[model samples]
Structures are given as C-alpha cells and as structure tokens.
Target: MKRREFIASAAPLGLLFSLGLGDVPFANAQTAGGTPVPGGVLNVAVSPEPTLLTSAFITTMNIGQVSSKILEGLVSYDLNLQPVPALATSWSTAPDGLTVTFRLRQNVKWHDGKQFGAADVQYTLLEVWKKLHPFGRAAFANVTAVDTPDPHTVVIRLSSPAPYLINYINTYGAQILPRHLYEGKDVLTNPVNNAPVGTGPFVFKEWVKGSHVRLARNPDYWQKGQPYLDGVVFRFIPDAAARTVALEAGEIDVALGSSIPLSNLNKFQDKSRYSINLDDGRYLATIFLTQFNVRKPYFADKRVRQAFAHAIDRNALLKVVFLGYGKPATGPVPSSVVNYYAAQTRQYPYDLKKAAALLDEAGLKPGKDGKRLRIALDYDAGGGVTATRPAEFIKQSLARVGIEVELRGGDTASYLRRVFTDQDYDLMISSLHRLPDPTLGVQRLFWTRNIIKGAPWTNGSGYSNPRLDTIMEAAGREADVARRRALITEWQQIVQEDVPVLDLVEQTWVTVSTARFQKTALQGDGLFASYADAWLTPKKA
Candidate 1:
C-alpha cells in the first residue's frame, strides 16, 4: 500500500488516549491482590516490530522497550528518578567532579556465561557509547578515560565535570555491553546487536522477524531467581484494534507503550481481571514535534521556521487530536521533565496573521497560484491517531498561511532512514524523548557537534549556532546546579529565537496488564524498566 493511503485506512482511536499518562490517575498501577505465584510466560505486546534488539548504539523507544531486558546498565532509577544500584554496587564522584568510580557487582554473568566485570564497563563507555550512542556522543564527550583498577573496580575520568553524567547511567541511555564479543567486531553490525549477550534478568532466546522476539529467564541472573516469569515473549502486532483484541482474548498478557487502544481500557475495569500502569514512565518524558530541515532553501531563514511554528494551532491540536490527553508543549523541555525546564521560554500561539507577515517579510510571498512554497511532510507510517491527525492538521494549518503541503510516510525503518539517516524531508513529525535530564537527551537535538550523518534521533535539522553550542557545552560540564540551570534557561530561549524545531505537545504514554502481572513497574522507568523483579500471579486467580 502507498504511504499516503496508509493513514487514510488506519483506524483512528481518537482523543481516547490513556489516563495517568500524566493525568489524575497518576498513582503507581496496582497489582492483583494475592500471594505472587511464578512460572507462567509473561506475554508482552509491542507494536511495529523493532529493527534491532540492543540499545548499545541505538536508542529508539521501541528497541529499548525490549533490549533493556537483556542488556543491563550501571544503575537503575527509583520512583523519584534518583540513581539506584544495578550492575554497579556503589558509585562515587570526586569533590572536583571529574573522577567518578564504581564498584562492580561480582558473581554477575553475561547471558553467554562470561563473567561480567570492569573491563566490559571500560570498553562499552569508550567504544560504542562515546562514539555511536545517539545521545552518548554528546553526553559523554568529556570522558577522558575509563580506568579499570581490577575486575570489580572501574574509574571514569573526565576532562571536565559533567554534572549530568550520573543521570544517564540507566539502561536505555548507557546500556553496558560485553567487550569480549564486541572489542574487535564492527559495533554497528556486530551479530550481537541482533542477538545480544548481557547480564540482565532475561537471556536473548530468538527473534523470529515479522513475528516476535522471545527471551528466557537467566537462571544465573545477578538478581537471583527473579524475573519470576519463566520467560517473556514480546509479540509484534501492527494493528491498534487488533492489539486490543489480543488483550481481550488473552492472546497477550500485557501491552506496554500503549500498543492497545485506550478507549477499550474501560472493558478491563474489573480490578480482579486487569490493571493499568502509568506512574513509571517519568524517565522517558517525551515531546511530540515537527522539526524542519533547515538545510533546505525554503527553511533557511529563521523567520520562515518561526512562521511555521506560528501557523501551528497547538491548543486545537491538543483539544481535537490529543483530546485533553496532553498540554501544548511550550518549549523543548516538556513540563513533565522537572528541573531545568524553562516554563517562561518564548511561545508561538496560533496566529495566521503573524505567520503570513513573517513569511512575507522573509520574501516568500504568495505566487499567482496563491502558494508561497510547496513542502513535503514526512513521518513514520501507522502511528494510528497521533501521526495521522497531526500531519493533516499541520498540512491544513500551513495551507491557510499560503504554504502548500505534501504528506509523506514510510514504515519505521524507512522513515528513520529518510529523516535522520538520509535527511530527506522538508519537515518531519516524531516524538523526541527528553530523558531524565536535558543534557543527556535534549542537547543532542540542538548541539552542533551532534549533527553526525546516519545517526537516528540526533541533530537532523542542520541547525548550527556557536553561541548556543558553547552554552550547551558549559551546561553539560557545569557542576553547579544554579549555573547549569541558568545555562539551560539560556539554551531554551536561544533555540526558540532560532526556531529550528517546533515543540508540539508533551506526549501521553500508558501500559496495560492482567491483574496477574506482579512487581513489574515499581521504578521510575516503569514498563521500560528491565523487568528484573517482574513476576506473575498464578492463573487460577
């Protein structure tokens, strides 16, 4: 089927997103009441088959949703989003903030049975993460060396203090990989990315492409006899309503990342039969946006970009499309991401008159055909309501200001290739995650050095501002909270003035599971959590 026709045929779930996906039901999802019994396979539903199974070099949410189960990181986060121990038993930073050291947990074995130690930490930090991780290239740029004093001790020496460093040690941001396998292999194409070996609770079993990725529990998991389900099977179901049907018919036990249509959630209201989880996604707070390819001639001027921002009716988009599920994003930092969020950053409301004047002033006046310029809107295929409604809304909104719109869509792999790898779109709409910290997740979107070709989720806009780059560098290296906060404030203001990408709305996320699912989402990352402690209640409940 053609990409344009994909949206037309997609069944819209509309305005019925999830609650506690930043709504009033913001409490941690309650589990079924009973003595937790283990041994059943935890069937997890994931939409759009993921392209890869590891996050060592890539950080797509779909990939992380599954890969984190196999590849563990140095630390995990708490309900409060504070760093907690995982593979690293304890960690400390020098008073100067340049030297950080961690004591590795002993007796840990990679899924392949190799003893996990400091060498793996040293190699992962220096090799794949520092160079290939989409966000790590900017986040870990100051790391000068990783010193392994022994099998259990690893020291990270940085050229400058990176106050944002610790926050990124979570599995999704800096997932540690085994060096014995990747040391001499091509990290990007290493067969291990497709079939991973790690120290997490689950072992990579097999990935039957176009179908599912199965993971068996690690009997030798460092956590000890945990991840109580006998195994986990992530099923790939592309249709939205079909996922809802699977959940209803017991074909799948749980749906994380809102793969199931939320409007149907009301059917599972029997507390004994099911539960909804929303509290644990704080670590992956996200913003939906339409980013311009500033390298293009029509978007070369900042006024043209700002005009595009003004043409967006964000409030209407939230009301009509999002159905009060989220707020209009005022800046790059979503309000859900606390600290360093500049609430007072400049805002562009829906003003067609202002939009038209900005375009005219930039010398892009309407032609005899009543259009200033024609541009293609590119986005991933089959995002259900989120992608389809927003693309059409933006296209119609731009038409009002004398801009002609052409819609473009592709499957997951092709869309990422076109936008981030090929840099092929005039404007593209996708959700960008602002991880627990801005320096860890947000800087890569605007920093000049992050414009590496073929890197998914990096700076694809070709926006370069030396002043903003310097401020971001200082913000990353600044150990003082007040100083870093001030720098982030300036960074937010400058990006607005430049208008490289239009921040659309804070995204809504959700998870659904039968009441039998136990101890799955107690951490800040929630469903994205490695599920090390996740278990299941006996079927007879």
Candidate 2:
C-alpha cells in the first residue's frame, strides 16, 4: 500500500493506543466532523541545540531536522532533490530569469494565530541579507529587493538572471517567519525563539532544554486530514551509540541523523528485529576542509599552501576518519552537483617528497635542528566524538610530513566565535553542512567584499582573488543558464587551485525507523523529510 494510504488506515489504532484511548473501537476515529482525531506523543531525539532556531543558524543535522518540522519553506525538495510547491501554490520566472514572482496560497495561517502574508517574505529577505542568517544567505544574496504587489502575490527582483532561483527560494533560508513576532526589540530572546510559530503541520508546544522538544498537531493545518500524529517530540541525544540504543529500546521512535560509524552500522543493520532505512548517500554531502590563515606570515606563500595539501594522505585519512563512510573530494563542489563540478579538475595528490620540495621552494626549509614548518591546527572540539577524532587524525598525518603541528581545541561556541569568526587561528578544520547550489557555496566563501567586518561568516581561509571575485559577481546577475554555469565552473577551478580551503570528504546520512513509519516517502532537504502524512502503527494492541 502507498505510505500515505497505509498511514491513514493504521493511524487510528496507533493513536488510540498511544493516547491511552484504547479499547475504543478503531472505527470511532472516523468522526463526522473530521476534527483532529488526536492521539500519541511522538518522542524523538535531537543532537544539540542550534545557535538560532530559524534557518539562519541551523548548521547541524539535528537543528535542520527540528526546524524543518516547525517551519515550512515556500519550496520543498522531493526525494530526488526536485523543487515542489509548499506554501506558494505556483510560481513563474521572467524570461530573463532575473525576476521571479510567486502566487501565494490565500488560506494559510501562522502558528501564532495570525494570517500569513507577503510581508513575511520582505522580513525574511532583509534579515538574511543584513544579518547573515545561516540557513543560506548566498541563495538570496543577489536579490535586490522583494515586492508585494498584492495580499497574495510576491515578486522578487534579482541582480542577475538565475534559472535555479526558484529552487534556492524554496530552501531553508527562504523559510517564512512571523513578522509580527520577530519585528520588535529583544526579538532574539522572545519566547518564540524557544517556541516558534509557523504554518507547518506541527506546532511547538514545549522544549526541555538539553533533552527533547515537543510539537503538537496543528488542527488548522492548511492541508486537511494531514499531520497523522497528534504531536512529535524531538529528544536530544549527542552520542550516536546512545541514539541507536534509544531507538532499539523504543525510548525513541526514530533516529534522524544516522551517519553512524561503520563499526556501529551493523549494530543497527544486524538487527532484523527493527526496520532500518539504509539511505547511506541520499544527498551530495559537501566537503569537510581546513582553511588556513593567509593573513599569517607562515602561510603567506602559495607554495606553503600547496605543500600542506601535498603532505597529507587524503585517501588514507578519508578511510580512517570516515571509516569508509565517505569519498575524498578534490574541490569545493561535490561530484553530485552536475554542470558545474568537473571531475577532471586538478587535485593535489599526497607526496611527502613533493611536499618537502615545495617547502624548500617557499623558503620554509627545516633549520639546523631538523624541525621543519610549525603551525597551529585548531578545531571545534564541541561536536563530541565526530569532530575530535578526525581532527586528531589530521594532526597525526601532518606530523608524518615533518611539519610541527600543534592541536588546539575548544567548545563549539567559543571556538566558532573567537577562532573562526575572529580569524585568530593558524589553521582550522570546519565544514559547511548545506550547499543548495555550487555558486552559493563558492560565493559565500570567496566573495571579496563579503569578508568585511559585519559579513565575516565565511572567508575563513582569508584568501580572495580579484579575477574570481568579478566572475562571481557577473555569475550572480547573469540570466542566461548556459553562461551562468560556465562562470560557476571557472570560479570553482580558481578556488581549487588557490587551495585556501583543502577539500576533504562528502558525508552520508543514515536514518532508522519502524516499518510503520514510511521510509521511501520522505521529502524535503532535511533528514526527517516530511511528516505531513506519517503515522505510527500500534504494537499489537
């Protein structure tokens, strides 16, 4: 049976059991009024609290899984990563592809009991452009302004023609936030931060700090007879082992981010007792890289940078760090991103002999004591086991090349603030989780002026090229699809050669849930996909 149809038939029984309204005939779930047939609290486990609730700062998979449940973007991605309509019924782009106008659905309502309107679009665009909200700023960076001609119509004017504009607008950065609540002072600390209101199928009810969050069903959801469960509870479990344990023990209904290590992959798969969704490589996960402080004297020369890339065994490190979970990437863009990512692009293969030669070429040869180049390697140790091990492995590999490397680690928040954002490190390992488009990622990291004081979100590499900057600008405004792609490919080539950010691996996400919860039917650019029609079956009740 289809996942939705199967859920519709089984939800009543599960709801009856979950809500403790059991022994009542399952047929009574079919009420005449068709009001919310409520039951059950879907207990879930999330990893950590995101810096910000809105898409702007949703870096971790846990945050994406949680926010996706609460906020509904205008456009959502299908399993194949295709754009599908969500809030806006349909949209059309001008022939030039520089301007896009959307026809908003008139009947949608915000979770705070207010009518959702075009003003929400204006607020979101301005905030993203001005504040650097993390969900995705590059996607909307070229948008000159947003215009609302009517209550149900919104028009976006771009600086350049972009065929993929609609797809980007449907991403997380374009998520609609309630203007009425976030417009005033202390908006950051408003109860809404902890508790958000959205037009999505789920409504935020409670958040137990450092543990789990709860979301009740929105009876007034735009889509009728949807949101099969009464509510969804998201629990936070940082440890992958504990998360898997909770899932197997039924302490949690589902485990969202399942990039579990290979050693533990079988622990979840070995058990035929529980239904597991083995979607090892759903999306083209972006690269994990180390950015150097070009402003520092030690790494000022291009030869020094080239030497560093050549010193490390990327293939061996990939296997050790990911345990064969991912593939080593050669450039900023992943292979999955077609039209722009070229496989033939130059890659700096590992060779200690060449690395030593480059160091000599850069005039950073070893002293009489035989101690070669020394540099500080910093990483955000706050990601628990996932962040620490790879960081240590990178250090060890660098040492093998006779390079003196110092390991500096700190809490996630402090590290991101003092080291990365402040540009106070020699070298650091970091990863950008989401890149809807290749240009979006490149623009954020390489745009010259974007590295200024207020816009220091990216550019951690402290590397920029005037030629590439102009190409990025022209590409952003170029309306011709073919020409735009050509520019993107050229820019990527420049980035790869500069080696400001040494590309590493493309991660894979895994998910495990009960068979009652449909697997293939998941949707959107998140781990949970969509729960609009998801339902849990009762356990032999």
TM-score for each model: 0.86, 0.83
Task: For candidate 2, give the lDDT.
Answer: 0.63
List RMSD in Å for every model shown: 4.2, 9.6
Native-referenced Cα lDDT, model 1 = 0.79
Q: Give one digit per residue, the lDDT tens place, for model 1 in 1-541.
A: 0122112223232222222244532223554245556687889887667888888787666788899999989988876678899999999999888999999999999887789999999999999899988668767889999999899999999999988888888888889999999998898888888999988888989999988999998888887668777889999888778888888888888887766554566677777778776555667666778899999987989999999989989878877775655667788887666677788877888899999999999999999999999999988765655577788888999999999999987777888788878898899987766776888878888989889898777788989999999999888888888988999999999998888989887754567788778784377677568877777776783
Residues 1-541 of candidate 2: C-alpha lDDT, one tens digit per residue:
0111111111100011111222322112110112333366676665554544555334334555777677777877654556778888889888977788988888889987799988887776776433555534556656788899987888988877755566565435456678888786454466676677888888887777876788888988888877878888887776666776777687887665443334454555433244444331244234567788888887878888888898777777765665544556678876555546666666889988888898888887788777677778876665555666767877887776677788887865666665546777888876554344655555767777667543334666667799999998887777777888788888878877777777776544445564344322544354635466666656644
The Cα RMSD of model 2 versus the native structure comes to 9.6
Query: Candidate 1 — which residues are off by over 4 angstroms?
Result: 1-35, 50-52, 181-195, 206-211, 262-271, 295-301, 356-374, 382-386, 410-425, 452-456
User: What do the candidate models score in CA lDDT, each in turn?
Assistant: 0.79, 0.63
Give the total clashing residue pairs for model 2.
Answer: 11
